[model samples]
Target chain A: MVVTQTNHLAGTEALLERGRDLSTPLLRAVVDRLAPPMDTVAAYHFGWIDAQGRPARSDGGKAVRPALALISAEAAGAPPQAGVPGAVAVELVHNFSLLHDDLMDGDEQRRHRDTVWKVHGPAQAILVGDALFALANEVLLELGTADAGRATRRLTVATRKLIDGQAQDMSFEGRERVTVEECLEMEGNKTGALLACACSIGAVLGGADDATADALETYGYHLGLAFQAVDDLLGIWGEPAETGKQTWSDLRQRKKSLPVCAALAAGGPASEKLAAMLAADAKDGDGEHPGAHEDFSEREFATRAALIEEAGGREWTAREARRQYATALAALDGPEGRAMPESVRAQLTELADFVVERRR
Target chain B: MVVTQTNHLAGTEALLERGRDLSTPLLRAVVDRLAPPMDTVAAYHFGWIDAQGRPARSDGGKAVRPALALISAEAAGAPPQAGVPGAVAVELVHNFSLLHDDLMDGDEQRRHRDTVWKVHGPAQAILVGDALFALANEVLLELGTADAGRATRRLTVATRKLIDGQAQDMSFEGRERVTVEECLEMEGNKTGALLACACSIGAVLGGADDATADALETYGYHLGLAFQAVDDLLGIWGEPAETGKQTWSDLRQRKKSLPVCAALAAGGPASEKLAAMLAADAKDGDGEHPGAHEDFSEREFATRAALIEEAGGREWTAREARRQYATALAALDGPEGRAMPESVRAQLTELADFVVERRR
Candidate 1:
């Protein structure tokens, strides 16, 4: 099993590398079209340059979305090149959201570097994000094909859902109680919609019929949920060295992540204790203690995390991730998936596996 | 001359009314696609509802862009209905910019109502602006025609220029001097590009060829300059009631608008004095007197306004507006313009005239 997992990781890494190789040049070219300051800021955000405009190689997060786009094109029986525009567009959108989300969430760092808003200021962050979004549509529609129109429509619909998800997430921060169902719906919209778009946009661009694109979208949607579940798990219990975040990072922000919601709904003694603790925290934090997370001791956070696990939050989330992974794989066995090249199917399966197993 | 001016005003009002009538329902329908809080916020921003989510009749800005779009379709020998999608898309982009700009500019009120960021907070402002932008592209691409693809490209390109212009505008606020040429370029991007797109997008949707769209685009580009020049005049000189802003509004904000740039370029004792005063204002406002405009006496603003006018700034700006208005009209007599129906050409001419003359 260990050997098989190692091999799968290697294959997925190769796929992601291929995606970055195919999409980065086009992404850079489009970003270059923006005027000076915005272009400089975008380059800095993309990790191609330092804040002072010097060249630097920093971590630009995993190019998983682009890989999905390329693989979807291949599944549609087209060369990966056919998916390059979709890959570039999806990457542009992903970064656009990052720039804005960093500002909205008051996150100062990303990928171990200061965020655009932190370095350049909030206005540039907003304007650069807007410019990137415009570039995404331009990249797709400039293709001037019917497929390009279809792809653009798909991308925009997914973008709206993504925005809706962000709204829901922000609203969730102020509330102490969020149903497990509400948490799942938000995650599905936030991460799932864009990933679903990335997985199928290239297929649409490559002349895949609606049925084929829908099947690929389904595969991606579940993969995103599984990926997000793992992410929630890491947010609580993962190693800070590997995740590049503090222990209980989500808890520090009082995020109503899937595990927290699940644990709250467990309805046991530990769950009740956890609920009372969080409610008190929320009340104290309301106006009395701004930045209250800073006041918590290491032991207190550990206690809360222990209570969450004891209430079966961690187990439930892990099981949910596995169930989602299985569902994503089952999408490949559907009628449309069966029509795709077997090699493409195998690659997609490996990518899904990588998603749930990723450390960061 | 009085009767002719009255007739022109009436004609333009009718055109604007027609534009609003046609675009409002579809715009509302598309906005409704946004989830609750966003949809509510957007509706409030559009003046369809009040702050408490109660129904209210308020001024939505003049639907000038949509009118231009509908007229462009008519110029292409298509009915106004053919331009409905273009009209809706252009309005969405316009509001998207307004929402973000109000936040960045820190303006509290617009059209006699509180700005979105003022009422809903900055995060919602950013998110809703983003959602509107996504909807704009979605509305166009969902048409699923070759014309829709072409139109989407035009709109996205214009949107990029708009973002670029905004970046330039914000940068200019930090500096004491800006050249007239640079000012024109910024306004051309900020206001002109979207207007140009609006004027041509409907033509594209109505099957106009590149040459025809280009001519109409040129017309709208110059018209936008004229419109902005008139707006700059109102910002400094118009009555507060008519303009829905305080007297010397732009000066209070220290905007390096066209008139200021032109006056600074004019090289005279008055110009020199004006430049020195502005430079000192910038220095004093830097960190020592944040929000220093609140401390400026009415006499000081009046004195500055007098200096700008004495240095030929006001005259030059007014003359520039006329120059652009004439140039816009000349576009209608160009080769492509000559092919448009005569009535359409006349309406475009009247619209350009009205743009230069408007008080608000």
Candidate 2:
């Protein structure tokens, strides 16, 4: 799954850059008046220094959701700047879910640092999440465009899907096993829905027709599934140095990743291996086996990863993602592309590749 | 303190009944659509029945916030139907707070049974809370005839306040002491903000003039403060049998309630007694004298309650509550009580009395 890097992100990077720019200014402006203390927590969660308002370099994530939104708008033939507000809205919504997810998952770390819940405590973390959700709506409302209300409705609908997805994820926590179809359905809601919303919203904001917006939505949906598949691959198989964490991390957590599930269903050496690993991990509460799985050389997990590849899971998912990206590009064709200008559309195309191929 | 219970909810109860009639159909409609498993949890939380959805004759509290909203709408000259959405909206918001509060506070019991978190577990309890929050917004959006965008904005604003209040409350935890002014500010954000929002939103939905809406908001503001004071009093001095909980429970928890702080500040015999109790409790926590405060006895706590009255804390707070209730009623300004012809407004007034006058 190794791929060469390209430097054609000028347009996509701009979209990502624009997204990062919009969130803080608009959020600060709103909370500065309504609820000043919230800005402290919001700033912190956004990876801005401390609650003390110190300036610090922070690694904001890929901003994939916001990128999809802006790129969709440009692809739908609207000026790139036209989708700025919607981009900000989608990004805020994404961060909102991340905040709550940390609390519910009881994950102590995120983005290579203490999670919002761990540092500030759960109550504050929950409030910060709520505040971000509110601010997303507020930003949409204040966009001052004619479609602001429509954009809000879209955002709200997408958020509901995200919440539903979170519920489904939580429901699986104590379950013995989950079907592949059910897993796909959960990913559709948790991951795909937001990505779809990003593109659909961008199209709508850019004055794209209903049919075109729907096409872009379909594209984003497929892209999301593939993105998660690759993410699952990296969770266990990616380079330790490149991924900035540890190899086989997901396996250690018994996270039922796509590869693990595929291997479990293989009914051979992989299945036997997975069954034994599951039993060992099932004794999770006592914490008696801290690092026990990692003690078993990565060879077995690597073999399992190879089995996932042989099962064609990674290639199948990647093909689906590419299909979606192509469909999105196709939807941007004809008179609409003429309106957006060729240079802009080219930039957005590169952004689509960025979405599906990123290592991190 | 020994007054009869007659006419306690004279005004508020009528308004509550009318509100119930208007909102039940819509709420029931939504409840019926909830996923079976989630619905089971929600039903239990709503006091419907023990997970089986049987008809339980449980009292679902006073429904004070919704009643105030309806009464304010009527007082501002809107029809009963006009206030119905606001009624349901306020009630849902209240319940959302309760769901999360139970989890954050680690309260094991509520409404004479296990709390929602206790029954459903923390993760599911969180999901339920999220579901309620989303439903509240969804319901607001479903009001076809209402100004959906405006309604959404108003609701979001109110929700932001609620979150801010929760943040402030959490901030108070583990703090040694705080000033009365800070306490009042926190109470306003936590307890008063939503109540005020209820009245203000009802007025907006009912087509009330800005001036009238502002007055109704003021009414609710004062009313909420009064209600909290009375509740604080009940936590200390109310009978355990009547209150349906242990007497002086707040004191046992070492909660920084208004009466406790007031008595401590007076620096007299009552203050001295409170200091001794607090020191003993602190010692117990340090393992210096295990359960030292447990030996103080409930009778001594009752005597401490007498000291609160001597410090003028109870009387001062009660007077404040009465004044707020009077202000809310005065805002109506109906000729011989003719403005609010519906029973709903009357019930709301009774509910206000319940807030300030409840022995519990």
Candidate 3:
């Protein structure tokens, strides 16, 4: 929000980089163990290499999720590396979903690069996703701790929920009306489940008691909701320079994101106008035409965004994001949360604020 | 084989039915526990229910893999039901791969029913496959046995290889030539690895020592090779009633099956002629046309099979099948196999013979 707040959140990226530095080598080794073709596709997908298999520098990710895992482990009384397996497992599962998501959504670009399916084809994408999924399980099983089985159970349950959410999200695209409650439930499954596991798994590996683990998971769950709420905001309103994509990407795609769902549920003139505009787009302006979603002009997108805001979607989403962030912070201060170190708690709180307050 | 041998192997279906009777309810329970919509797709895919979510009788596969699991566990001294979890896990994995394989290959039918992707769409198919995969791990983890992690690890490794095999299979389709060695490697990865794991995982869950597990896995591995060889034979020659698909499915699709590879590797005039026909199919026929693979006439497929047979491919594959069967039998009788009960040993021998000798 302000210069001081921005500076306070500067450590987020640093923490992420620390996590990448800790985990990437092991992740690389495990992925490289796949069959040669799969390994090549995986490396390419991870941004570790170009399509030719030459070394290439890629952001991989912000490592935000892995940081949560490691920080949760530390909060649970183990060093960050003790959470490495959990970190790797979650990261692999994330990529697995991304690979499939790219294919399913027909997304051509992600993180400023061609999507894996775009580069390697959908068949390769599917198999590579499957391999990554299997590898995630393998890595977790090899944790060699007494809690390894329980941790694995945690990951699998989370994965199922993630897939469930994606399935619902896809199904939503086909429906004329999707309730706000359904949208939130889908978001929780798609986003919250993995984030929740990202913490609880670390807690398990770090030998935390159930109460402490539950507190950390609650923190992550709410943080995930906050993150998705903010992401929905950014998808419609953020500029390309900041969000790393075209303007109004979600509106153009007619994605039933949180803000749009809220606005539609508001059921006023703005909502009616927005629905009519989208319906007309689907009727004549290439919305229903395959590959035509990207054809929306700048003026058309601006109108759509204006409709959502006028429908009260923007205000509702912003409020929900803040509410979720507060819930996350409160989760960290709950009775069982005392198990978390003060430093860890502060870092998590700042991360929650950073997620909701991010400009990109 | 005589009537006596036929009578001996008739119990194979009975064994499969018994295995199905033991594992289906538990398997259904595990699958139905997945989130809504996903549970629906999974139930339909497994033939546990109809697309409408109503209970409907459907062929739930031959249950051969589950029978292998339970029988291997029993041979290692556990009761049949003690292996139910292992059976369920392997069966889930089998269906998982089948779902993805059907999608990847774009097959419209499986087990005389519309394939999951064909009916539910590929996106749903992919997610359901993932859910099943995650469910397999969850079921295995819930076993809470000392060997649970190890068994999960075994399943993960098998899954990875199975994906590798499928990747290789897909890649081979675009190639001009595929060696028999490459074909076998793909077969081993795609088919043999999981079958091997089926036996070994059962052994593990049954508390069998590593030697016993290894012996059983070896038997299944060879049996897998033998099974694939016979399957390749049936793909070219078996009647539609026996295989439950259209005639000449593999040849029409230009699949680089084992027998075709063997024939191509023969390097005779017949091999040259067969190659020429395939090359022409690629050039002149719809081979180059996406979705044109289905345009092949029955007469054309007959000619392709005739060319493969004339090239000595059929004879070579049949001989290889018998050889692999014998090797599998030998594996069952090896010193390491001494831990297997006599009755179990005899049944396994009959199964291997039946794999190679069955007309289908």
Best by TM-score: 1
Off by over 4 Å in 3: A1-3, A52-54, A275-296, B1-3, B50-55, B279-292
The digit string of per-residue lDDT tens for model 1 on B17-62 reads 9999998899999999998799999999999999999998899987
- The CAPRI class of candidate 3 is medium
Cα-based lDDT at residue A158, candidate 2? 68
Candidate 1: regions farther than 4 A off:
A1-3, A287-294, B1-3, B287-292
C-alpha lDDT values of all predictions: 0.90, 0.66, 0.82
- Put down candidate 2 lDDT per residue, A266-337, tens digits, no spaces: 566646655565655566433222233555567866665666566554555555556555665665564444
Residue pairs clashing, model 1: none
Please provide, for model 1 over A1-360, each residue's C-alpha lDDT reduced to its tens digit, 9 standing for 90 to 100. Answer: 122788898898899999999999999999999997899999999999999999998888899999999998998999999999999999999899999988887776678788998899888899999999999998998898889889999999989889999889888878889999999999999999999999998899999999999999999999999999999999899887777677787887788898899999999999999999999988877522124487898898899999999999999999999999999989999999999999999899889889988889
Model 3 residue pairs with clashes: none
- Indicate the TM-score of model 3: 0.94
Provide the TM-score for each candidate, comma-separated.
Answer: 0.97, 0.85, 0.94
Q: Select the stronger candidate by TM-score from 1 and 3.
A: 1
- Selected candidate, larger DockQ, 1 vs 3: 1
DockQ of each: 0.81, 0.41, 0.69
